[model samples]
Target: MTGIRAALARRWPTIVIFMLLGPVLFMLFDMAFEQMSQDPGLTLARLGNWIAEDVFFVPRFVFMLGALPAAVVGALVAWRDSRGLASGRWIGGLSAGFGIVIGIFFARNLFIFTPPPLGAQLAIGARAFVSVVLAGFLCYGLSRPFARPLLSQEER
Candidate 1:
């Protein structure tokens, strides 16, 4: 469709960045999974013991390595969209962060078998949601200084 093509044309840089980074992100996740699978029993034992302390590491890594870079790329795209005057940085960052988190959830579901118990699953889901939201907010805060209102263009 023309509409889709137009949108892609307008946002090609962001799309290209995502496309380039996606495989690397997936590979990192696969490596993490492979490491866990290699010693499932020991990993499980360690996880059980450290659930309260380190259970958030994976989500944090996803936010930092996966979402943050994507958000920065998106912010750059937004800056370009604003004709180099305003960034719209928070909007881009939040959208990218949320998108990455959703993608991660979907990928986990698709690739991972042997589901954990319901309670554990629920806890993990909740943690991921919270972590993503927090990361989004952090990105928003970090971006605010760079972003300007689009309406300012007309005012100038």
Candidate 2:
């Protein structure tokens, strides 16, 4: 208990930041995917309606249960990336979100409706995990060239 309190006392700011950041990150991921799914090209104007629609939907409400944790993981990725490199957080968050989506997809395929062969689940899990790793690296690489130039001199 003392240890917990001490940790919290030292880390409360981080805790609070994450509590605020998590929902915003989740909403951004949700909006980006929803927008892309709705149209392959730009649809910025439609976002207002989509956000309003999203909040009222029951399925989305249920999915938020899963997404919040995933978004927090994304937030962690973003936070880590921010520490090391500028502009990495955007793509890092996207990659991490994609990783979470891959995980959810695998779970649904392997266990949600019907159990698959043990070998199949193992194979899929290995592939999905590798994909997640590669995606992060790829996104990080993509962001590297863009990071420095995008920042102001003060930020750099």
Candidate 3:
């Protein structure tokens, strides 16, 4: 318990920033999913319903969209804290990739109701997991070239 508390105390700023950014991330996910879907109108309507009808849904959605990705970014930031700006850019890209993956899973589950087909569920999970990981790697690869360190040489 003490260990967990200590970690939280050390990392509270990052956690809080992520939590605050949750809504923005959720909106980005919503927009991305909206664009991807065949019917944008229907997507907007469903999103509206979720926001208006269920208070709990938004928080969960935000958590999945925001907190999960933020956690990944935060972990990377902590891991690569002393690293340079290149690392920062990679972190951003990685974070975005993760956010998108988590968003896709949450969005699919939100809209699609799969029947009790164990195999189907397994397949979907596997596919989604693989795709998300691939996307993350892609993001990392693309962003690494552009990344700049977060701190200056003097700081290091």
Q: In candidate 3, what are the lDDT values of residues 62-123, reduced to their tens digit? A: 54655565555544543343233235456556645665566456545654455436554454
Any residue pairs clashing in model 3, and if so which? 84-149, 85-148, 85-149, 86-147, 86-148, 86-149
Candidate 2 Cα outliers beyond 4 Å, as residue runs:
55-156
Off by over 4 Å in 1: 1-69, 80-113, 149-156
Model 3's alpha-carbon lDDT is 0.48
Q: Candidate 3: where is the Cα deviation over 4 Å?
A: 1-12, 28-50, 55-69, 103-108, 111-156
What lDDT score is found at residue 111 in candidate 1? 30
Residues 70-95 of candidate 1 have per-residue lDDT tens digits of 54555455445545444445455654
Clashes of 2: 0
TM-score of model 3 vs. true structure: 0.41
lDDT minimum window of 10 residues, candidate 3: 141-150
For candidate 1, give the lDDT of residue 145. Answer: 41
Candidate 1 — what's its lDDT? 0.48
